[model samples]
Target: MLIKPVQDMLLHNADHYLIPADIVAVVQADNNLYHAFLVLTKIKYSKIPVLDNDGHFEGLISLPLITEQMLGFDHLNTEILMHMHVSDVMETHVKTVQAVSDVEATLHLMINDPFVPVVDADGIFQGIITRREFMKSFNFLTHEIGKQYDMIEKDFSSSEKTN
Candidate 1:
């Protein structure tokens, strides 16, 4: 049976690969660093998006980002977390993609990030397109292509033997 055309295989929009915003775990920008750390630990995620009170995508916060501030010459200053905010150390200037963006572009961006955050024109947090999701689709596409190639080779071999 035929599958999707090669050009169509990987060109789907970012929304096609989205892990929607509602299901995503997010920490508020104004949340204290300690709370952010707790959330990351509880969720067991390396990083999570940060949102503002208006629900705009601010950036991402991670355990490492939280701990970085505590590193000192003699000991970790864990006390800093209580006084700081997620915005104090969260990574801003993250690369993002639009929902209308092509999967090819999102895949390229994912090479540098575990997930590419999605946003609207107004910077509203839409969701994320994760490398895991992209790879699932990519693996399926390649597997289907390989199957077609094997079938073609088998047909060619049969035709040659008949001659």
Candidate 2:
């Protein structure tokens, strides 16, 4: 199928796909690893956004990072790492997308992340667009296309009978 129509649909309905920041759980860079870990565990999120003191987006902290850091300490008690700051373990180089970004671009960005953080032009953290949300939209589109195709087939059959 042609991509233009899908692109148009995404562009027109872009706002519906966004998850606003208020609902997203974020961790502060200065927060201790224990606090960040608690947030991740309580939310059941594999990764969470890291925000600086000014509430600007900093990076992402994931379980893998915590695990990697814990592994480095060897015999040191895991609790020791908890006292460390999330800034020490969180990935600083993060990828973010503007709220106005097209679905195609967002999808591409999501290939490397569970969710892509949305930001305003001024770099203010907004919400995130999760892969789950994108799949839901895709499924709806395909279902609608199937219904349209069925209608066309029915119309074609009725015309043939009249002829």
Question: What's the lDDT for all of these models?
Answer: 0.82, 0.78
Q: After superposition, which runs of candidate 2 have C-alpha atoms over 4 Å from their true positions?
A: 72-76, 146-163
For residues 1-163, what per-residue lDDT tens digits would candidate 2 score against the true structure?
3366566545545667788888899998999887887888899988999988776888999977776666653463578566799999898888788864567778888787778888777777888898888777777776665553433345555557765
- Using all chains and alpha carbons, the TM-scores for the candidates as numbered come to 0.81, 0.79
RMSD of 2: 7.1
Give the C-alpha lDDT of model 2.
0.78
In candidate 2, position 155 carries an lDDT of 58
| Residue 36 lDDT (model 2) | 83
Alpha-carbon error at 101 in model 1, in Å? 4.7
Prediction 2 TM-score vs. true: 0.79
Off by over 4 Å in 1: 1-7, 11-16, 146-163
Evaluated with TM-score, which candidate comes out highest? Answer: 1
**With candidate 1 superimposed using the best TM-score fit, by how many Å does residue 40's alpha carbon deviate from the native?**
0.6
